[model samples]
Target: MIPVADAFRSGGAQPGQDALALTGFAAEGARAVFTVAGAEEGASGLTVHYRTQGEETATVTLLANGTEVERLALPGTAGAWDTLETGVPLRAGLNTVTLRTASGDNGAFELSGITVADAAPAPTRGAALPYTAYEAEAGTTDGTVIGPDRTYLTVPSEASGRQAVVLEETGSHVEFELTEPANALTLRHSIPDSADGTGIDATLSLYVNGEHHRDLELTSRHAWVYGEYPYTNNPAEGSPHRFFDESRVLLDEELPAGTVLRLQKDAEDTADSYTVDLLEAETAPGPGTMPDGFVDATERGVTPDDGSDDTAALNEALAQTSSEGLGLWLPPGDYHISDHVNLTGATLRGAGEWHTVLRGSDGLGGFFGRGGTSVVQDLTLDGGATVRDDAGDHAAFEGDFGSGSTLQNIWIEHSKVGLWIQSPTDGLLATGLRIRDTYADGVNLHRGTANTEVTHSSIRNTGDDGLAMWSESEAVSDSAFRFNTVQVPLLANAVGIYGGHANGVEDNVLADTVTSSAGIAISTRFSPVPFSGTTSVRRNTLLRTGGYEPNWDSAFGALWIYADTSDITAPVVVNDLEIVDSTYSGILVSWQRTVTELSVSDVEITGTGRFGIEINAAGSGTFSGVRVSGAAEGGLDLTGGFTVERGEGNSGW
Candidate 1:
């Protein structure tokens, strides 16, 4: 299948327009290109499966390698994706296929994806095509394999077959290629359980066709490793924990044929190796079928109540769904939870964020958590009447959540942290959230998190940074924090990026910051890696940032970027950054170890605290279109030499 996400590489197609599909521009003269691979050289045809907002007929010219091959007619308006097919000439190998909008009476159209398969009649819809990896299949090995009863450990095994492959070292990898794209993949493996509290752990990162997609923790959850320890929520209380049952991982995504699935052990410090026994692929279940995998908590004797202790009930509900890839719906009620809840591959949802409330009991450590595709949506977490947990003691939501996970439309109040996301979590999306009066940061994207986005949310009255991307152990990269409102941060920066790669803080409204920290801070205080990659801070409005604290000298600044003592000897080399349209001291790049390659433009500073743009650090950058009005100091305070051009207004330099 032609991947719509890959269409953006050729231009004219919007990447990630929808979670399921991508939109290709179809305006007159607009062209969208896709790399189509053909197994055999044969007569080909172009099929356009698209969705349009209007009902005007449109024509798209299909060109193979810049030569027009076919012109397809579209029905234009369809609530769902519609198909238009036309024959085309083809050679073999990888073809450069282009779709140009030659004529569209509606001006533009949207396409989910284009298909360039053989002219053969398309197969009947909903066909059952199953691919399984049996023990008889010809399997390749990367490391030693020991398998007999159930698993193959890297160390040694008495029984050996195609079912198991073990990696003893961190760099060991096993690769397998498939002939057809898989819609879903399920794998069973053996790794130490964390609930067992065994420091032993293992992690595996996947490489599809040699491209890294996501990291999967090969370790097992604590609840499964140890018998019901106050949090397992499992009804069978006396059953002993068993390691013989392999832990299963389910992935829901489209993988093209000839896709090479590689399992590479990456975590070096964790000495424990991993064992895999069974791997299978099948046609993905359609939407709404995901919930069929779940077992309801209420069905398992969980009663919702406001006054009584509902912790055991909710815990029991979570246990049934753990590792089962199920969806749990919590009916509207005021349930009281007394402890933390860990979730995996489960969707814990409520009727609505305001309708269902989970009030924390006295001395409750934290509220809810997740580690995989477990979704927590439409729920509100109230800290109850009193908070016995101290600052940085507990977070309402905390976990090492991996890819394909989401937290949406959740309201959190009066907690140590609204959401504390640990490192190594990739592709996590947190949106439509209202978090307030937190003891610490509202949302903390810690180290090793990649491609995480927190957007369309409101964070206010935070004791520390409202929204922060901080790296400590591993590395954090390619994450975005945008379209969020942060107000009245009592301690730290409103929104800040401590250290990471390609991380951004943009289009946010920050106001009433009470401490000396700036509205937005880009620093390398505790970065896991040297601060590299492009970070953009743009279109943000900062109201009252720096001057709130009277005793503190460095109280106010709209934007601040610097490296601290924790940065060691490596000066942060920011590849590129664009700071635009921020108020107060428009942009402040200070400190000794902070060196950057920055571009400041379209910034206007109204109040006086500091210069419009201060470059006190040992770095090189450029400034343009910066204006200073009521500056207590000057417009541009360049202790370190820098270039300034296109000064739009009269200012001190």
Candidate 2:
């Protein structure tokens, strides 16, 4: 512990034997600098003891080695002294730490002292769902076994357990025995790419008990990125990689434990080679139903299963629903649309995602909602876009839900984005969504999207972040992403929060981030509005996440806090997290400018390619109950003038 008297005061800070009184902080840049000597190098905990009489929270900026690292919000103590803690990295020997008023209006407070302690320990939390993971290399295979290697950037990394089985010829097969009863199966595999780099489509035959079951269609259209970070699909730009995508299907009947399952490259399967990595089997929920009092779209001159455009008729049905206060329903069939269908305060229902299909051509079709309480459910939106176009609004679902909306049981694919909800929207409840093969984010609540929740959704094979909240023009506040499963995103984090207030990511499962990012990221990047209030990341599981960042030629962490763009002074809580099989670091805390007042607890990290926890920035945070094991580069790798104070109960360096 370092006493306040040891700190050098400036700009009206009065130092005492044990405390420092900071006054006239309403004046800009008033600060106190603390110089600590003989500190051990590594990640450590920093706790501030202070008291304030202000009615609102007081804001302070933390600087390490003259670079801003965090903005800390001090809760009003009502004249009573209280303590707040965060994690900090310190160098061996002398280190400089400074605290300043964030703004001219920052409330005054008296600091008692600060404590630097050892990194704490946390309890373990398991995966979110109950399922068995079967590695292809461990299964009985007639095919040749491939690598546990990741030396080339032109090849995709193995999915799980660091190995895969490659079926190079027809009739080659890999078989497995079910460990539990399962009705749904997800296969992680790779196939040859097209010469043009667009991708190729192939099929894999499934057999149950030596009897032919069905064929699963697999595509590499959304995988195999080339070039540098934020990769492109044009093969001419660079070498191709990220050579994997997943296909999922629900079985007609649940198979009991110990049932035999085999995936084979039949004669009809024309791919040059099939690389099978892993399989995930689970029981899926039943389908949903359309509510009563809904009018059928066919009655309003809409045609199903036709190749013609249905955009006009769809708009007519939706408009009628809005005017007459009726719900519109589309029966099970394929409907093609060439343009957008405007929806306002309407309820749109479909038979099911697999049954009711709305296909768009060359990034044209989609539903754009304006205002009022809209409801869209039980439908599949397929935007037939072959390439990415960031400047265009080519998402399957776009626009805003004025005050409230509900989107449930919808599947979206092959678009620039799945759901791009814009600014000023609120009270959105999105659940049971299956979003895949997108060119960008699966779901993004952008700019002033508040009081929204996206839960119980499956997002996979995205070209960018699977789920994100970007506070671009205005603050996105009080929103959440919970109980969702995200897998195999080709680029960027699975879940990201960029400058939001009181937002949270909880109880979600994230895995297999290909490159340039992590499983989950909280940052002040992209020049969004400054963060306010508290951000919570809790009870989430990350698997096989974190990979090489090509731009920086470094590795990211499974969960990363990047204070870049602006100062993050708001409080952040990361708790009950389980990170397993990280390609690099398990947890990383970095700062380009400033970040402060972060609390992480009850986090378990295992099998990191690099360190378990890597701190490469200047900031103050408190980490407790964090346990690490099987880190290749030891535990608590700290740099950039950071130090560690050893604690108890942390094991496996």
Candidate 3:
């Protein structure tokens, strides 16, 4: 290991010295060169300790005998030094290394030192690794790096508890030094804002050991920077929360030790930026087990198939749990609940999904209700009683919570509504569920829900939307639907956000939605609150949508955004809303004179029964980086009043 003490010693160092000394701060076009002697050369790596003084990016080109090897994008470190490494081909005798600013800007940096070493061995991965958020605050939760115990280099002052890194321009990169080689990196990031008021649309290219590996285009629907936008009514109540687009970039090649992960923008002209909050490196598979600390429902006389009401016994068991953290386990039983079972501040688990079934009766239309800091997992909720013809509504599970409620690994079938949730609720996580054949919506989060997630689940044969987030009276902000499979919703959308702030639906597959409405729908006509938060729809595939409508002129788009004929005084401003990387069959954007600011990018329309994107919004929106083919009607059906920044690849409609 090269000591920090030895790196500061500069000037006229011997070629065979263990560490190479070089100056970092220099004017544009001025080259700072250093020499290193290789002991034996097949393939060697170079470790660099350098940093920048200001916000500008610094790029250094390395040369071996006047031949360029690679260009390394060095991240700006405000004022403190950071470390990075690169793979370089070396001759057996001597090699030359050069550094220069990437652009003609007034960029300056501090080169602490460089060292040549042998390439690292292959990685041996074991368990999935968790990386804690490294807050940019100095003395807060910013101590350890993710995999190995390493301190964070000095970060930009713009970073805070929410965003760990804030990127500005194209080709600007943020470098991370891995303590151990990581096979894959999973991180959550979001765009703060765009220059033209559209949402984020850019490709992020990854560099490993100063060599280009791969790139993935990212789009964001919300701002991670606090105070960047007027989110709430009181501007002082800026969103402290972060809505990260959870992205996993694969490293098909092994990342050796001394790896430098450089994330740089690939575009050249656009002035958009993004922020990262949390990052995790997967060394192995993720953990799957029930969380500890819970009382057994069987111990409290909640037996299986006894023809007796066990809801009271299960509730009593949850009441008897420790006050610090409430929990109860229903182990492999069909427990009947003839009355409404209400729960709060508790956790209910089971042996498995089908093993433990909670059967509901006609007197108890709503099965299990929950609120506040609760979890329901690994069980089936069977609404054995059919809905009465005169009844208003009923659900298998319903929650009206404040925060931190999760429903996981559960099955609910043959219900009027599988799960109906109204909010005061925030931070709800619903994953690993199988919900099918619902008379109404499979799951609905309406009115004041915030920061909720529904991921990795399957919902099919729903009468209404498979999943919907609506802001009837309050802002439903910062919620997400990811990696979900929705099939055959009979009446309404497969997935929809009626009106919300900074919500996202990504990486989901929707098929056989026999509705005239969009398979994926977004609208603001029904919102009681003023709508303008960023809503992102990306990386989703819709198969065979928008063939039927309940009424004429109803079923329109595969991915639809509407404002309708609402006379709401406040403009329905969807600032930085984006739909990208989606494959659709119906009309793409069904704009009905309502959307204020929007962007559509990287959209591939394979088949559209109507138009590709029909825009009639009152204000200007952009359609860039889109490709349209196999559409029956035109690519874009503009009904006037919208300005589109038509980019590239839009043809053959």
Candidate 4:
């Protein structure tokens, strides 16, 4: 056996030893050296209650044969030996389990009890995994799409079948809850523990209702950690809950209180012993307003019936409120306004994250060029369900106030159009907006706007493009579109991330698209051109293209763009950019007209069809770094497409 005590006493623990003692092993003046061992077994597992005497910081190790198997960190104390269960396989006959005071503080060590047995079989995996989905906080609930592990919930149904996902968190603790608690829910997060001073033996528990279901043992030495607890069952039965009640217990402690859940530790020294950190929960649809802190509007006498002549009272209150002002809550009932509901300086908040909804009725239609400079979150807006189908794409909320308006975590659906922003006062700062599930393009930039950004929001089940806009000076980056549904006639392009100018499309992925609509469709307008611009498309992934299903048409491009006028159809004028690893085609250059200059590189096409890289350079452009292999009938093809300069950098076509 490789005794820890012997190694330390032999001076092998250090490179040099004192003049009066042996070299290496010993620390000039360390107290004592001792050895502890237990029987060994093959396969299964072993449990041993190793006895330790006195108080001294020492190192203990479980050894198999003469080789080290498990390194253990032990505390120095004057108490009875504790039972330690080790799960590891050993050589068939007589494995040597060793323990030694790798340090000099020294104490006695002995095996109180040792037991070896065969290992149990692994648990079998379930036949099918649960599906999950998420709803857009910025638009209306058109259709709900469920994903694997039920991690994603599309449209939380008022009836059944689908559930809502929520993400909740504190500095060191996080909790994920769903709208329909009955559906299967998951709680996954990272916990960064920075405390090491005190001894800590933490037990992680998973509770169903008030009963304990699973328990995990966590050691303090493992400060940086990641853990996931999944609760699966039909929501119709009951939802999973992350229990953090002080009255909860996992393993029973033989104490007076009987079943107690607490941190137990045995420590020797207490120097700079401190640990303070947060457990962040990142499950979908948690219990909190959008973007963390948001106040309710109606609760502050700012509702539609707030005793003002029109929406003027609410509008006036906005200009005098803070950038982080209260939300413009509409409650769950109907609200009517004679004039436009302008919001500026304040916030248009909602009640209970996704519970409270604001519905417009009568002559009010829904909303107008309102909420100039406000932060909107966690509110559902069902504007004028009474309005006719074709209402000139009116909006539930419009960003006419330029710079100070920020919209995040809002669900606006069942409207002619979610938002029709005409550009507000501030050019670059006129963002922090999110347009989710609207009746039409969630938020149509509609010609006159610049400097807008959309991130981490869902735009699905829209009547038209999930989002589409155009402005010679506009750009869009870091946006996404996945499963937006359509019922009757069609739901068009799930996402139209296009504009006449430099529309920077990057880091976006779309899957299971069913329509002829482009996940991202953009086109150049020539009628009224701007001073300078070229569309820069890069870093996008498209999965399951083609709307052949009940959703959209199959001719969909995860990312697609074209020129408005036929005269400028070819792929020419596009400039310095990179399109890589897209769904069907890493970078699909779809242009009807000709261009001045274009370059395509490092593009990976995923799917089954034509060339990985297709240059529709009816105009004139460059194509390079094109990768195509997974699908594509041919590899590289050129119809109206071409390249004055083209070839491979990362092309695997």
Candidate with maximal TM-score? 2
Return the candidate ranking by TM-score, descending: 2, 1, 3, 4
lDDT tens digits, residues 1-653, model 3?
Answer: 34332221111111222233344335443344444444445577777777676767777665442335667777788867787778776543333444444344332555656666852321121101122222322212222222210111112211222125555656666666666556667554555334332346556676777888887556543222233221211224443222234344545655665676666655752436555544545332122233355666777667887878887876677767735464777777678876566667677777765367787664254445456566677777766433222154458777685454667667776566777777777666676677755656888878888777776677865657888887788878777776677765655688877776777777677765554446687765554455546677766777665434434544457777666534122322222122222223344444445455566666666666556676655656656556666666667777657666665655553
- Candidate 1 has a TM-score of 0.55
Give the distance in Å from residue 72's predicted Cα in candidate 4 to where it truly belongs. Answer: 46
Q: Each candidate: what lDDT? A: 0.58, 0.77, 0.56, 0.38
The true-versus-predicted C-alpha distance at residue 114 of model 1, in Å, is 15
Compose the digit string of candidate 1's lDDT tens values, residues 141-249: 5765553221111211211132356667877777777766675554545565443343234556777777876776544422132232211223244332222222223
lDDT of 4 by residue, 1-653 (tens): 12231221211222222222222212322211211122222454666544445565444555432233655544544555565566555432212233423334232344333455542221121001111222222212222222212111222211011222222211111122322222122221112222332224444443333344454343332112121111221223332111110111112211121221211111311212212111111112223333233334454455553434435555555554454433444444334444456655455554422345555542244445443444455555555332224444347766564442445445554465676666542321211122333444565665556544443344444445555655534433212221122111124444454444554444444433333444455555434342135455445555443233223222434445455443333232322222232324434455556555555655555554444555464655555655556655566656774544655565555
lDDT of 4 at 289: 33
Flag the better candidate by lDDT, 2 or 3.
Answer: 2
RMSD of each: 25.0, 15.7, 24.1, 24.4
What TM-score does model 4 achieve against the real structure? 0.48
Q: Report the C-alpha displacement of residue 584, candidate 4, in angstroms.
A: 7.5
Each model's total of backbone clashes: 10, 25, 4, 92
Candidate 2's C-alpha runs over 4 A off are: 1-135, 149-163, 177-188, 201-203, 213-225, 228-233, 245-259, 278-290, 641-653
Candidate no. 3 TM-score: 0.53
TM for candidate 2 is 0.74
What lDDT would candidate 1 get against the real structure? Answer: 0.58
Worst 10 residues of 4 by lDDT: 122-131
